[model samples]
Target: MPPHPRTTSPPRARRRLRRALACAVTISGVLLTTAGTGHADPYAAPFPAPSMTPSTLDARYATERRSIEQALRTAHGVGDTGRARTLGAFLRPGRRFLDFDPRGRGQAVEVIGDLASARRVALLVPGADTTLGSFDQRPGKPWSTPGGGARAVYTEASRITPRPGLAVVAWLGYAAPKTLSSDVLTDERAGQGAVALHRFVSGVHRVNPAARIGLLCHSYGSVVCGRAAGSATGGAAWRRVTDIALFGSPGTTAWSASALGAARVWAGRGGTDWMEDVPHVRIFGLGLGPDPVSGRFGARVFDAGPGGHSDYLAPGSPSLRNLTDIALGRPESVTRA
Candidate 1:
């Protein structure tokens, strides 16, 4: 028998093939809409009129609890301590139920502040392995505890000068992946979760019509945001979303921002984060279109300093400072410090 010819694909060709496959997977994972539909009209009536009822609120809470529990179980099975901690925060009584079905698993929006006076509203969407328990830390716990990112951002925003009448919400209202492994990258679970996220944002606007909402999406949460923002259906109300920020984001490109009609798009990635080297490729219907930090996407990229993936919101991290500045409409001077 003739000797089988040795397979000799060059390194460059192999890399190209991998990139192509990744793109295919990403595209297959996300269902793209050709036409815009659900975005709320800019001149629509103010939110929180007769539309939000007590009955609707109750139903939302019940569903959200179930979703959070499911995420916790999944994280524990995968041995993801960070995710488990986050889920623990969600299970807490008051902190987890503050927002209405933000994750689409069914939760009601808990009004923590005076909504009527708020000039700007921010919805903080967390990424992989997120759960209700990840919102705040118990006393005496390490400052490096999980789920501190969102809380830190909220606290920092609260302390900003001329805080712009802001309402910062920690929204763990999406079904995020339990780990960073690529196994779950383009699964339907995440895509369905994205759909739910879109509905939640719209629901929020329906209740708080006049608020200028900003979406702060981190890590894989950026994927959820991209999918939700591009959704023509429930995204109609998002026209009021003045700014969208992504940190340590896996995806958030000009294509997504333009599709979402966001007036401003900002991105930052920590220099030490592995995502800096992650190839920009869509896979199996997963991933956002392109990298926003590539500079070609027109996003206002910022310096996130030396911490890796989770450093964006680290205490005293430049990225977190910049985030507060953008949320408060302050200058970027703090970011340069």
Candidate 2:
């Protein structure tokens, strides 16, 4: 034969393959995302009690670090390659994991600086897509990794002028909804997260009862903080919180900041934060409620500049600077929105 016909896949077959690949990718994203939305059954297993508050890190560090190492080994053995790398990095020398449980997806508390002597503590509650496996930050990634934003905040906290013995806590304590999934649209996960956050905050207070505690919640985390704020009245732990600053918040379910029950509530959004486009209404408890940054919501607004949704903690940005100022109790220097 002078020539042979070339073999090629049929167009329909090619289309089918592409669709299959897209679906697989979507499912992978959902599965691998640390910030999951599914409601966790409280009865699944007996969860361990967190460390007693005010316990010196010396008493807790050795044991917790061992837990992290054991969890890392389990991840590697189970072929959870993503989680393996994440847990491994966390086991690096000198890095202390305040609390760690590798069971299921995982839960942890990573401190940026010394917590024992710090007079000011910033507890960062992250939004969706935060899990131990996905917590590792790689350059060129956005909000997908916890290290990006949490590390940024940690670094900025240390840079505060006249450094105020501040320690930043990157708490991946609750299960967050998968980003872009239906879970992000509801408050179920937030409700659960709120309970855990409340407990964590209470324990934190017991550790350094005099520390000036501030909550810096981002995205759906604002919903968690909002829920915790509701029942925090008449409690000393809740009263210890000085400022509740929300950025890129979806909603807080409250009509006004005063309803959050914090001493001072502040809200800010990057000029281009897409969260502003999310609807601000409650529907059968399926929605995020109201936008905290809206004029009618009545939160003290701060300057977040014209950054995007993920840029709130970008170093040198006005949002980061303002947050540092607020954390240091220098509200007078914060630029107004």
Q: What RMSD, rounded to one decimal, does every model reach?
A: 11.4, 10.2
Q: Which residue runs does candidate 1 get wrong by more than 4 Å? A: 1-96, 99-112, 132-147, 162-164, 180-184, 233-236, 253-256, 283-288, 330-337
- Looking at model 1, residue 332 earns an lDDT score of 50
The ten-residue window of minimal lDDT in model 2 covers 1-10
Encode model 2's per-residue lDDT on 37-124: one tens digit a residue: 5855221222344474565555566767777666667666667677777777887876766677776666777777667667888888
lDDT of 1 at 12: 74
Each model's lDDT comes to 0.58, 0.73
> What lDDT tens digits, residue by residue, belong to model 1 across residues 1-337?
1111223343777656655754454444334433445653222111232233333654455555665566667667767576567566667875534343223222223333434457777777767655434345535332222245545666777766535577666666555655434433553544665676666667667656777777778877777666666554534467777777877776642264466554577778776665543455565564445787875666777777766676577777778888877766554554531
Output the lDDT of residue 163, model 1: 52
Reference-based TM-score of each model: 0.65, 0.82
